[model samples]
Target: MLNLNGQTHRRLAEAMQQAMLIPEGDELVFVIGRGNESSNLEALETWVKESLDVLEDDLALAVLPLLLNRLGQTINHWSPV
Candidate 1:
């Protein structure tokens, strides 16, 4: 399983919401394959790469960070702190 911080979750939620605003109404689906750790992570990476493959230059701005740990290790690069 994977874990994500509240802020990271919110940011992804917001990004998805905004992405939905695209004029053509193109829907985005996140496919995460369930399996062993490496297998799942690999699938996720592939999905991300595929999703990014279609993003327009200007629209392909930020790829939010994943919070795999709950300790202080997880840092949001955009945060002032």
Candidate 2:
């Protein structure tokens, strides 16, 4: 897992809340495949970008790279079931 500071954690929480991607008081659970043709990352990027407003420009910029990097690592290590 990526080690995030408190402020970064809060910012991500706020972004997810604003995006309404996760229902209030609930958690998000999903899976992505390790296949080279998988479009999950692209879809996630588009979704996050579309969901953000002008006020979230910095949040998007800050979180996206970290998010993508973590996802890439996860994908790299994923073993097919």
Candidate 3:
């Protein structure tokens, strides 16, 4: 299982705020997937873009890759296996 502590959560929350995914001053409670299987990065990218398309924030959409990269880094850092 993933073991992200409070600091990691806060860091991701702050990053999401900066990316405008979550509004400033609003609280974000996100849950990472609990499965142990690896996923396809290309599919994940497509999914993220499609999911965020409704928001119509071009700048935020542009930053999605960076945000995803940050998330990958955080997960790699905290993954137990």
Best candidate according to lDDT: 2
lDDT of candidate 1 at residue 54, scale 0 to 100 = 59
* Model 3 stretches with alpha carbons more than 4 Å out: 1-56
Candidate 2, run of 10 with poorest lDDT: 25-34
> Between the candidate structures 1 and 2, which one is better when assessed by TM-score?
2
Clashes of 2: 0
Predicted candidate 1, C-alpha RMSD: 12.9
For residues 1-81, write the lDDT of model 1, one tens digit per residue: 134444554455446545655222222222342333243334444444444445534343332323244233645554577
lDDT of 2 by residue, 5-80 (tens): 5455456555755676544431231331223322443333333433444437676779899999999889988957
Q: What is the C-alpha lDDT of each candidate?
A: 0.41, 0.50, 0.47
lDDT of 3 by residue, 7-55 (tens): 5544554554457554432122122222331332222333344344454
Which candidate would rank higher by TM-score, 1 or 3? Answer: 3
Q: Give the clashing pairs for model 2.
A: none
Clashing pairs in 1: none
| Clash pairs, model 3 backbone | none
Quickly count the clashes in candidate 3: 0
Q: Candidate 2 — which residues are off by over 4 angstroms?
A: 1-54, 79-81
Residue runs of model 1 more than 4 Å from their true location after superposition: 1-38, 58-81
* Worst lDDT 10-window in candidate 3: 25-34
